[model samples]
Target chain A: MNNDILVTQEIGSFRKPQYLSSVFRKTSGPELSRLKEKATLETLELFNRAGLDNIGVAGEMYRWEMYEHVAASLEGIEFFGPVRSFDNRYYRKGSVVSEIKRKNSFHDDELTFIMNNAARKIKLPITGPYTMADWSFNEHYKDKRELALAFADILNEEIRHLYGIWSKSKSEVFEVQIDEPAATTHPSEMDLVVESVNRSIEGIHGCEFSIHVCYSTDYRMLFEKGSELKLHGYNLEFANRDTNELGTGSEHRKAFAELKDYWDIDNTKFIGIGVTDVHVDYIEPIQLIEDRIRYAIDAIQDPAMIRVNPDCGLRTRSRDVGYAKLKNMVDAVKQIRKEY
Target chain B: MVKIRSIEYGLYPRSEHVRLSISKWERNALDHKSLGKLMDAEKKEILKLFNKSGINFYTDPLINWQDILRMVASLSLDTPFEKISRYRETNTFYRQPLVESYPRLGEIREEESTPDSHLPGSMYVSDNSDHYMYFLPGIESFVSMSFLSPELNRERVMDSFLEIYLDLIKKHGMKRILLFEPYPDSHFYEGNWDIFGSAQVFYVRYGLTEGSFSERKDSGPFSLIASNEKEFDVAARHSEVPGIALMNSQNTYLENPEKLRKSATKMSSSLKLDEIFVTHTEYFDFLPHVIANKKVEILGKVGD
Candidate 1:
């Protein structure tokens, strides 16, 4: 097996530090600002402590969920009394009204916080156009495809501003991970999904465009149309679907087999296989992580293109569980690196 | 004569079927027969709920209809490879049309794969239901017609489904066809001339919004699937057709009908609806509450 493959990064959103949870109720003012800054610093330090190769700038520190962060950054979005939530715990964002427009490119405060606090180059996770449109109740757009493309234009403006911000930091490889949890739900719109995504990243040079999906999806379709989008990699959820299946030859080795089938056909894009399951609180043993990684390498037969990460964000998990999982993952990668 | 009136649509709750069975099936815990049995039970329950709710015309409850792309491809396309028709997803799963998959798009004959007769035991819900049962075909299935030849107009996609409709009419004495179109604005509907002209064509869009309920004459009278009074108001004002007010039980979204009472009362007083279909077909024990009172008859979609 080729030993050049590297395991690096967290998917995005880490668990909120406990110290700031109590103070989150303060909607605004100097106290909220100070707490946000503290959370940002603490999150960056945790990344350093965990030894993640490609550090993730924690978007959670700002206290907005994935889609809401993008919603908050834009103009023409009116917040109604209605609040939508997936789990009814960590996030509850106001349901939107009116046509979403680009009032500003990106959230300058979040960008500034990351620029000041991040010790290394970061992976910026932006909610993709397809997902943004899918999660919201549309008030303005006539067609679903049209709404998605308009969001693409909005996201593109944000990406251009991000490019300008990161350009000053000398971060040559800016990986902008587009989170599209809604793509698979609307399968017939796959063409529009890819097209809108491609449009969002158009003229975005110097940055690596990676599409991240938290659940199992049509990865093959993404690759079949990858040549057009020119996607650099895919961060997929595997471990959560089959937590018990580990190593190369387990009888229940469906996840790895699925990955192998995709790689056997299209191996051009980088594959970041999720070694840790984020839904549960269990801290994966370092040995299990080693086995999962080895099994993935064995399945794909190319270690050069493989990377390691969690199934999705650890926002739901406790801060301690999240950190423990990250450290174990990092340690396992180090062990595998030494063996090679 | 009483107009043969009804609200026609289908509901596939993720909690009850696809996510419940297939995830276990993928892990080899549930065998194919057992999976089928489970789905059959689910359908029976869904239909029972529909019957109780007073809905007359409804589509079959398809548990794993998401795999519809593959199913339709296998039944409608002349392609040999099953892999081409498989459902794919990274964050989510959906099927692309055969036109997107085949490079020789213009050469294939999809009609050749059209069965000589309606496939028996295809929709068990339709076979067993007491109401005017209908079957659903994805919009992508219709687009397969455009792949039949090089000079194919986009309208031919709609025409292809018309052929399927006629075949069903001959074989099963089928009365109506419901097309599950999530995004109706994206496709061409002109080729559906004969079907629209002669047969009852119910274009079912699952989640209703005010934007979907339009004033334009081209936007066909919507059988609005609303969960709240706001939506009911939109439907009442814009509907050139009847309205289907979805009960909270049928939707993942939670809305207070109590909160909707004021608007529902106001709209009912002003708007003259030809018919009103109260539908919540997913819950077996669900009995829909009448939300509107007007001079016109507010009927259950079909029967009690």
Candidate 2:
């Protein structure tokens, strides 16, 4: 019951658009090719150092999520996932649009297959319908709202198919993570995105659905309807902020208690708060991690549904930095549990 | 008079050169490539006359190389580039060790000795990485989706040229030195830099010594690093931050006949150098200064 959900990036280089371009080389030649190879191997090293065997190919070219695929490439360590190659942008031959349309195209499905094949717990993530619309330039739809809803439909289709894949893969994938990092930027789509998510999961399934909203400095508004228009849990960041300063969450801590006060905030609709920060490359001390954990526990007063994790996905950190933070996080939680 | 003038030398990514970009990037760029090349072709063209010109102690050209020559040299072997003194790592190449030795195709590799003494001090070359081979089947692309395979042995590949590059710098004549060291892109990759292929810095035995271009014999070509400036800076700052700066500016930029005649006027000025270096033209301009302050070396590029 005292378990907490956390959110962090692997390294921020993958998944995020702005960071990807930096990894490119000028000579677009063999030198560039060599650099790409270097980046991949380096990422694996980072993962191993963090004590995490799983790596999600965040969806460029390497199938880092599948154990067998990356086993040899990674020198025999398992922990990997696929990047759902769906897109709201240009429908070029090999673009996101085509990848998403493929059968069992969602990351959830791929991750499920991986989990089943490797006999491991799976982490299924997707760019929420609304977030995808907000970050991408939509051409197929008529208006902004329409485009978001249309994306919602596409996502709904993927969710249904993902359930099917889980069954076929023989893996019980209950964690359905809808990554809505753009939740703050387009709060307008909040309703549409939430609705589409609800609609998608309506009849198709019985899985623990979670929404990952991050990279935003503010989430005060999303706190109001913590219970309404919801799925399973909301994995939000309370650490990796705009600035590198630690021990703070955004500019105002005023809304800190808002989510805790929400009605029906329980084990079903969990609130995954970041206990450690991944930005600035500074790991959280055990005391700080404990404080964050305590804050969530006291505010919510419901340990059963509290999910504590790093400020966000540590996709951006080197292996040492990320793992140390997570290890501290897990340790702090255990400390809290002992006291409880 | 065979006067010996002082030369100042500081490695790139050093503390002194750290803030240089913040200040120097604003200076108006001269059309040195065109007019100077024309001047080299035996034409007369005076340029950038109004601004006060001190000898260039550093050049910020890219290390855009195909191989790991410069990274292996300055960071691993302690060998400086020939003519120009900047670092880069993409689309770069190396000339033969000496006038007779054949040039290497990719990165420089060290064979059986210390490096600084072996390589040439200067040479004119171009970025020559082949893209087709990079795009070959089985190569990785994309972050989460694009997959690639490591094509070559980073160590052996670098050493192949190290042997010859060091020998060349030690023996042959050099005009401008070129280095191919890459700055981390994920941190600052807008406009000025256009790199993305290898995003993370190579690290090794000790810890996170990534991001910096350091020369260490114990590690060979291995770097102790992560993938950003802060980490890299820490590593570089810790790597004995080479002192004893020396700049030997003899025939760097002022070798032309007319430029030589023109520089003769400034010769009467004082060249009080605790440490100073210049191209050949700078030597002419500061003749009197060199006589007064006394530290002038009419050495060829890189003293090779």
Candidate 3:
């Protein structure tokens, strides 16, 4: 495995282990909590074993399942049965039925757990505010803006709490990746999205801030208009569309081609290029990943301004598939390092 | 007189009957035609069950539009549509509203607003006679203007919908349009009051707006879907205006029907709501068994 890449991280979430899932269903309160922590440590150990540069303790924290995680934590939000969409089931719009109160802070205990157990720096993913508001049914707040801002305020408190924990531990936090998968859908609300994001990260310092959009998004709108947003990096899905573009002779690497648009954004310190497509089962060849990385670096016209990651989290994939994908990604990065 | 009408928010069902079909479709085992037929049947069943809930107004099942994304997608966005925009509702579920270069108001076809029916479809609901049909040309500004340039005014986004209503009013004598403005907190306006002012024009002197509530001086009574005590307090504070309370019956409120009943009971006692709208009729599917022997009756039937 290549250790040449500065950071090889799972976006967030790994598939819940089968034994743990069974134990969770069978066990009660404290026993279930104990199993969850065990599973989290095991999950992180698996990633570290996979030789990952960054690890996140995602067990039972709802890693990057933005709305569900927030709904599980916050007061006033109520979740119903799966609302059947085209093919998949989503938790019905979590209605804000009461005044939103903090039931518990997010990631503080999880980060503490990670710091004590893991050798690598932790990359904690907090679901961004826009996603929480956009996905839920706002029965409480007056508008989407208020709903999002309320989520932003809650998230800010959680982030601050997390930062305090991290500071006290004095452990390395690779970066805080704010997952805003909903940002690009409603372009008109980009202003609010930007404002809400700024609110979520307001005043917290020392930790790097990265925004991860798990789909092909309106980067031009987000980066161009959201220039005021405090950010250190932008992670987006490229391999989901450009998997076919991996062919050496392929003329148009359409996903990477859009990188030219974001080349001029001043506030964006780096682009965490998604080189693995998490949606599929096929293990992407190291050569293909190397090609994708090379194309992003070439297209963006900077080698230092690039990091490599999967198109999204691998929680959906089986553990075997997820591990294979990460191992391949790291190997590809190593090959690139050798070539360069 | 002010009337309280129940409005349904459409999130499709996954009953045991449709579960296999859904799974098959997800696995690509079932084609679009089969899945469409299965989903259409499921929606009909859902609506029928909803009708039995004894609410003031019945909203026909509207499950086909896969969230707002699929709802907006039926329209023909201008050519050279760039697919850069995406909204991921879940890990797997998402909608990418393609950027329409030349968005024309005329591009919105009639079938875009209609419920799922294979009968060479028309614009209006199949049976608007029984209940106040929730009609719309397209989703409001936040979504309709999503793909359009961000600089455009929210009013401009409402223009096409306004024209559709104008035509409906002229042709069908469409009296009351149920305005479904979902996002009132977007700072698109200051509060629910502000959203009501801009949107009231579309349904002015004629229809009902449920999602975002406000007091109307020129039109019908003020109405709102207050799910909790605070929202009820806000609606009650504005008690000077005659209005109806449309309580959200979905979510955790539905799990414990007793809680919902208690809230509704207390709310009605505190404020004289002209009418109470217990929303999301599908959740009430279990109501028959639950309320079978119970004397606590929070819902009553209404005949229009």
Error of 3 at A63 (Å): 5.5
Cα lDDT tens digits, model 2, A239-277, are: 643222234352323334445544333344777776556
Instruction: List clashing residue pairs in candidate 3.
Output: A143-B184, A143-B185, A144-B185, A144-B186, A145-B185, A145-B186, B176-B207
Give Cα distance to truth, residue A49, candidate 1, Å: 1.5
Provide DockQ values for all models, in the order shown: 0.03, 0.01, 0.10
**Which candidate has the top score in TM-score?**
3
lDDT of each: 0.58, 0.37, 0.57
> After aligning candidate 2 to the native by TM-score, how far in Å is the CA of B133 from where it should be?
46
C-alpha lDDT (0 to 100) for residue A159 of candidate 3? 88
Clashing pairs in 1: A184-B92, A184-B93, A187-B94, A217-B89, A217-B90, A218-B88, A218-B89, A218-B90, B56-B302
Q: What TM-score, over all chains together, does every model reach?
A: 0.57, 0.41, 0.61
Tell me what fraction of the real C-alpha contacts between chains A and B each candidate also makes. 0.02, 0.00, 0.16
Q: Which of the numbered candidates is closest to the native, going by highest lDDT?
A: 1
